[model samples]
Target: MVRALVVGATRGLGASLTRQYASKASSTVFATTRSSVPKDFPENVKWLSGVDLQKPKVGDDLAGQLKGEKPLDLVIITAGRFTTEDFNDKGPNWDEEVTMYTTSSIAPVFLVHALFHAGLLSKGSKVVLVSSESGSITLRHESEGGGNYAHHASKAALNMVGRLLSLDLKDAGVVVSIIHPGFMRSDMTKGVGFDKFWDDGGAVTTDDAASSLVEWTEKLDISKTGEYWAPRGPGDIGTAEATLGKGLSTPLKLPWRWLLRKAISVILLRDTALVWSLLRFRTRTAIYDKTLFVKCGLPLAVPADQDAGDDAQADDPDGHATGDDETLAMG
Candidate 1:
């Protein structure tokens, strides 16, 4: 009787995740794509339209559906775009960066907002944001080969957005987690040379990613909200025993009364962006001041970190970001 909704269910990792849930027989899956649903999709799957990741309707449509149907047990955001270069800097192809960020990062957060607004996810509903370690600031420092800025920043933004959602929904017992799927062979990485990941060789399969995610998700405890995880480990990532006093344990200390206050703030409020800006500013200020060497009381701004608030505002002067596929032939 579990119900799941998957955005971008027509291809790649999204399709793989949808198949796993639909085939389980215990789930009623709603699969969405901008164009057509696959002919081979399972019988339990319902196909819907108007869920393009780049548009506001993506969240609105899914929220309407979830409000009308049974409450969603799990919602997965898998719509994404990738590029070898940061399209913004890679001139003549900047649309690629816009597309990547809109699909992979911005849209997923909006999807969560819609669900919250519609009251579609009951207490304890689970949400998954498919992120990548390529988005990890921790991992980027260790990358031997430099590049992939657009894809990397988009995923990192996705992670931060997940954290933001967790802050809003944690009190409702809703669990949100960001998952890092290891390198896989897919359209996103097409034409990229990797002899070891050749079709004939030992490459990670989409099915493997889906199965691993489900296995870990199934075993997750209620207390493990707002955590990032990989499929490579042994013990559960969200448990006190696993982390032994890390970030995952912080939420457990928040009083239940605080969650009540948050739920009220969410329901009675319309200033979502204002709330987000303030919270992000607070978090960034705390982290930057503590981590970076401050000179003249101002944190040193790195060239690569070029003022996101300014750039995002400048890039979308009209206040609406467009999708990469907007100009593509959907037919």
Candidate 2:
């Protein structure tokens, strides 16, 4: 059976993915955690301990766990933390701050490197980095309040690392990609506006988000390596084409099917609008023509038209001045 490793799989999206893969995919899942896992987790899931991904030996421990099992299939790095306060709120300078960001940004790349070094992701394997738009340099112009320095920086660093790894792993047949999970209603963002979030279609349930993300990842072509994805759906990428090309570190190429579909959709929409406009215009013209003819005292043109005139006349046949029979017939 296929095998997959999900780093940071204790809660939220990771936990949901654990459930999803266990229920849906026929694979032995290794869910990584720093401490304990809930008792209610699925039976097929193996909760591995001490997954300090930022440090060494993480890949080794993972490799050892899967040594006698089925071939390694996929690796998803979803381990992350968010601190709204300063970098060193609880502890002293840079160590805590550095570790937090490094785990998110730097460590995953090294983990992939370690995996390849150990021949785990030899070929036909995939790696996904659960990143955030908060790390995007393109979004810096739009950021407000900017206090989560370590979190933001770490994510940005993670973006860079994911891109580089995508390039490095391209020839190895390992597809590397990054995904933004949006503002999910999880322990990570407790007491945040849940109602407004769903109203705006931004906050997604962990199950919904995981299912969609896995579907997107599974649908990725060899051409989509190194692309940035928003779990909220498509069209939010800053430079999708450019990023897709470089991030995978392969020759720059576009998904021609995507371009073709977009062009066709645009054409079909234009045609549909034009057809509707023409039909509406014709309907309005017909209505105006009939109204004007009736007001000008011209003979009714259709059976329904004649009936309307006859009905009006029956209501007040003599109310309207009876003109000559020939003129009234012509009208």
Candidate 3:
């Protein structure tokens, strides 16, 4: 029998996943909610109430509640909080940012750790962290502009947490998947004024997203653990065409190369002394030349020469250079 747990299962995708899992034969579904269990909740699903992710002891609370339960074959953390922000009018709200980070990023670490220590997660188990495409730095474009700092950064932090968890559990035969469950027409998005982009973004119902996630998790294993994926593809990613080009494939793997290159670029750009030292050592072998940039997954164009009209593009004609002159091309 498959024992699955869906955190934040009161509504939206989490609720849908709980229902679907409960319907499956030989499956036991467990769901968590911060409030009382809703009326007419699925009879088969075992609901655990008062499970707020923001609380510091949330993980311990959950582990204690499920102490005698069967080991979980799959665990999906779907809790999230979002708040809009803009520099011109609505600036970042400290309280909202704290709540968002705590719910989305911070809680997952504690929750998973407690579960592992409690022996709720065993070998061959799968852990899914429900992140967003907004977490992807490479997918960010000029079209989206800048705002919602905490909303975006929190998801990014969750992605990193997922990757680290995957590494830690690899030898234990546990798989950790970080995924963008696609744009969904949910209260969360509607409350954030994303409803305007629903039609244009190809946003689907929560049930649809949940279905895809369940199917995707079925195929997940140790081989693809630690990877970030968009199970519903780039159709809803506004910058997909502008940043990654057209005719993109489904279940897109958000690249880690861009993250690597951006990190290196940020270091070089912020530290003038480091940049100067690298420039001074330009007379060294080819390894010290543009090779270092290439190895770090950075653009071949030297950072010092960015303003020299050196707009080097990727070899692919469909590709484009980012504002920082980073080359992004579809493989």
Best by lDDT: 3
Candidate 2's C-alpha runs over 4 A off are: 86-93, 191-201, 234-331
TM-score of each: 0.66, 0.64, 0.80
- lDDT, residue 25, model 1: 76
Instruction: Order the candidate numbers by TM-score, best to worst.
Output: 3, 1, 2
Q: Is 1 or 3 the stronger prediction by TM-score?
A: 3
Give each model's whole-structure lDDT: 0.65, 0.64, 0.84
Score residue 115 of candidate 2 by CA lDDT: 72
lDDT head-to-head 1 vs 2, winner: 1
In candidate 2, what are the lDDT values of residues 79-195, reduced to their tens digit?
887655542554334665777777797778667877777777867788888987667644443324445678777887777787778888888788887778655767775643334
Q: Judging by TM-score against the true structure, name the best candidate.
A: 3
User: What lDDT is reached at residue 323 by model 3?
Assistant: 39
Clashes of 2: 3
Residues 161-220, model 1: lDDT tens digits: 877788888888888878776556776656545434445433466777678777766766
Q: Pairing residues by index, what is the TM-score of model 2? A: 0.64
lDDT of 2 at 75: 83
